[model samples]
Target: MAAGTYQNWRDVADLAMDAIAKDPDAWGDAGAGKNCRSRLIYLYNRRTGQLVRTQIVIQLSAHQSGKSNRIITAYPRGHQC
Candidate 1:
């Protein structure tokens, strides 16, 4: 899960789910995980529906042994490299 105020967002969970449903825009080898998937998703605040935040969801990799892929983190897109 994302740290700071992102966790408190009303649609934080939804954003993560959406990311999994969408095709990753970019990816790379994340070492032990085999690969990393980066997707863009939007999170909205509960009180204000107009409040939208763009986040990048990095999934560790596809399932292996029936286990689902794990999300490394979600952070504001374009805010960092």
Candidate 2:
């Protein structure tokens, strides 16, 4: 049976966690500021059922007031700017 349209949330959460644990610098090195954003990329391959170690590019945002940031959006780097 089919469910809602947001089933991939789990996958994304997993990826985000993995990225954070694997490469904390990738997100923190993007820039410096209370309202800065960062990107984390990982290669995904279905044939081997594993990441190709390339880059997925997950864009996240930060705020000056709050201690936490939010995910603005994500995209395939080659497909977008």
Query: What lDDT is reached at residue 15 by model 2?
Result: 65
Error of 2 at 43 (Å): 3.6
Q: Against the unseen true structure, what C-alpha lDDT does each candidate score?
A: 0.56, 0.44
Question: lDDT, candidate 1, residue 81?
Answer: 20
Each candidate's TM vs. the true structure? Answer: 0.50, 0.38
TM-score of 2: 0.38
* Tens-digit per-residue lDDT, 43-66, candidate 1: 555455544556766655544564
Clashes of each: 0, 4
Specify the highest-TM-score model's number: 1
Q: Candidate 2's residue-wise lDDT over 1-81, tens digit each?
A: 001323264565566545644554444423444232234555455345465454444454554564535544443343212
Q: Model 1, stretches more than 4 Å misplaced?
A: 1-14, 62-81
